[model samples]
Target: MPGREARPAVEAQLLLASCKGGGPMQKRFLFFLALLLIVSLGLLAACGQPTPEVIKETVVVKETVVVEKKPVKLVMSFVPSGDTQQIITGGEAIERLLEEKTGYEIDTNVATSYAAVVEAMGAGNADIGWLNTFGYILAHEKYGVEVILATVRFGRPYYTGQIIVRADSGIKTLEDLKGKTMCWVDPLSTSGYVIPRVMLQAAGIDPDKDFAKTVEAGSHNNVVIAVYNGDCDAGATYVDARRTVEKDLPDVMEKVAVIAESPQIPNDTVSVRKDLPPEVVETIKKALLEIAQTEEGKEALKQVYEIEDLVEVDDSFYDGFRATLDAAGVNIEELAK
Candidate 1:
């Protein structure tokens, strides 16, 4: 009875064995083997076909090449003209001129303050710059800037400083400004402060110890307005600013007259970093001095500096400026202080 009962279990085992021997597993294995044989036969048949001798020839091939391009860049900066606002617009004109002359792209920068432009030069932000006599001196002393060209005023390579007062106020000479209020355009202004100070000293008056009150008007036009509006008894600015104020703001200009004019001071100049390549600097200097010969260049010069030409000048021209500052006993160190 036990053997007969276990007969069902034995039949089930035999069924499993039959399934393992003839299931989809065996079919899949057979199918795979047949496909592999077909692929092998196809490869053998393909190998029996002839390969062209021309196609089998060995040949050398060259490698591909590539090149990198460099970028062109230049930056020019200048302080605002004391009154004309020409320095800002003038910079744009000069940038165009430089591009035309050198075929190099340039970006122009304008500083509200001349000293700030000098700071840009020290920081290596401006590749080329325009600076007043005092600003140029500071840059040369502090940063070794090289002066390349200077403006010609009244057909001379230098300009003058003028102390002005209201035409009706009767402040007629350097002596008259004593014990009176005064407005100096800017501390770094050569004619506006430095040269005027020298003129005052020549008359035996000290600007710091003499003026009842001193104020910095920040621009030559502001200095003129300060005098015209009776804000100060006298105002000092570059002599050239008077002409611009007369042309641009005639009413305001008519109310003021020059009471005293300082001795000749070298005009503003264009400078480059001393470390620049001499050849490049020379090229730039040549273009600048020669600008007056071309129609566009002449127009730009008139627009910016209001001059017919610029001349190549050396640092020696500024020696008189330094001497004038010294003669007045004005220590630039004290000015900064």
Candidate 2:
């Protein structure tokens, strides 16, 4: 500790004796060798056991162990305009299950419009999303969104849109509403707007130019309300929205009746951000696939999404939607832009 104070007299005497027996050249070599040995032993004795090298190695190992313990956060975005409470309830259940299964915390964001979900995906606001068929089509075309799962209602991968009217109203069919007021849900909604619009166009009626009044009610529930309250002669909305109405607002259910049913349209799909890591995407796909198999999950999903299950399907299901729009001569590119 005090710098090897005055080398011990005994050690000095021994070193001198060893040097005395050698010629001048040998003495110099012996002196240097003795000095080297003394310095090495002093360093070893001062460092205690396991040396500085061992301590540095232990620190490096501990640092690596700490780095390996970080957790992953996965964020999901879903539609949130109606029965938000039910939506959050179902979403959190799935979030908790996903966290348990994958060991990653689940974070969720609710988008007011289907188009807004697309925007969230594009802006990197969410790692996964629930998007309507119309938004799915637009996202695939413009944002390259990756569809990993499809929600099925009543054990089918597709659902329908029913153009409805007050049962007492004179409107009986698509043609009967030619000069009547009509309400539309979101523009990027498959059953709410796109499919219904396509069906109307097929019957030689132009909703924009021929209707007496065209109003946007923003959501499927709003469209139902508009028609039920006589705010519009007819309204376009997804069939599941009618279920929500029957269960939540029975008063409206008794007032409206479906006069026209659009052809089956694919239900919403869960899409992943294109840039998400492959493993994370796989984990999401697995979690979604499991949701339909469990009892509580099935019930929660049915209440919020009316989804009996989630099925794996390829991108081809949406190709028909594109074909339908193309047949109508509608420019989706312009709409998404």
Say which candidate scores most in lDDT.
2
Q: With candidate 2 superimposed using the best TM-score fit, by how many Å does residue 67's alpha carbon deviate from the native?
A: 2.1
Off by over 4 Å in 1: 1-69, 251-254, 331-337
C-alpha RMSD (angstroms) for model 2: 12.8
lDDT of 2 at 201: 88
* Residue 18 C-alpha lDDT in model 2: 97
Q: Ten-residue segment with the worst summed lDDT in candidate 2?
A: 1-10
Off by over 4 Å in 2: 1-65, 251-254
Alpha-carbon local distance difference test for all models: 0.77, 0.79
Model 1 C-alpha lDDT per residue in residues 165-232, reported as the tens digit of each score: 88899777888888999998877888888788878888988888998999988888788877878998
Error of 1 at 207 (Å): 1.7
